[model samples]
Target: MEIREDDLTGQQIIALLREHLENMHEITPPGSVHALDLERLRSREITFWTAWEGDDLLGCGALKELDPTSGEIKSMRTPAAHRRRGIASKLLEHIIEVARQRGYTHLYLETGAFPAFAPARALYQRYGFEYRGPFGDYADDPNSTFMVKTLVG
Candidate 1:
């Protein structure tokens, strides 16, 4: 599969992000759901990417620059039909490499505390991210699981 920087204009990616938001809301509490919508993901601070197998869009993820020295992983999702294919893992690895290239000292992400999010939490853990308290603008929320990884040169 090939992963490319996406402009977020294609119908497949739009739908994928919509599904991601819907699923996040379905599983997480209202105030604790931190997934970004299409508009929010379009911010100048965010770089979005999509994984494709020729004509098929497999999944998508984004990296948002929180500051000069840190970044946040956002909107990581693989469609229901494409789960377990390592699409999420590839996108995550790409994002982390980009963060390292940009000189980011740390990479942070916030996912749900629910059982539905266990797979996601496991994925992050495998990448060396450790559970941490809230960072950036986040507050202490019982439904949120925050994680951070300090990048090495």
Candidate 2:
């Protein structure tokens, strides 16, 4: 599979992001769902990527610069059909490498606290991300689980 920067214009990517947003809304409470919409993901500080196998999209993820030394992972999603084939894992590893290349010394993310997020939490844990208190604009949120990984930059 190949992972590369995406401009978020293709219909497949748009649909994938829409599905991600929909799942966030479905599983997380209203106020605690922080998934970004298409426009929000286009922020100047964010770099989006899609994972593809030949012509098929396997997954997508993004890295949002929080500061010169820190970044946040966002929009990580593997389509239902692509689950458990290590697509998300590959995308995440790519994002982490990108962060390191950008001179980021730390990477962080926030995911749902529900059982629906168990797999994701496990994935992050396997990659060395440890549970952490909220950072950035986030406050104490019971529905959210924050994680951080110190990069070797």
Give lDDT per model, in order: 0.94, 0.94
C-alpha RMSD between model 2 and the true structure: 0.9
- TM-scores, all models, native as reference: 0.98, 0.98
lDDT of 1 at 80: 85
Per-residue accuracy of model 1 over 93-142 as CA lDDT, tens digit each? 99999999999999999999989999999999999999999999999999
Off by more than 4 A, model 2: none
At residue 13, candidate 1 shows an lDDT of: 92
Candidate 2: residue 134 lDDT (0-100): 99
lDDT of 1 at 45: 99
Query: Model 1 — TM-score against the truth?
Result: 0.98
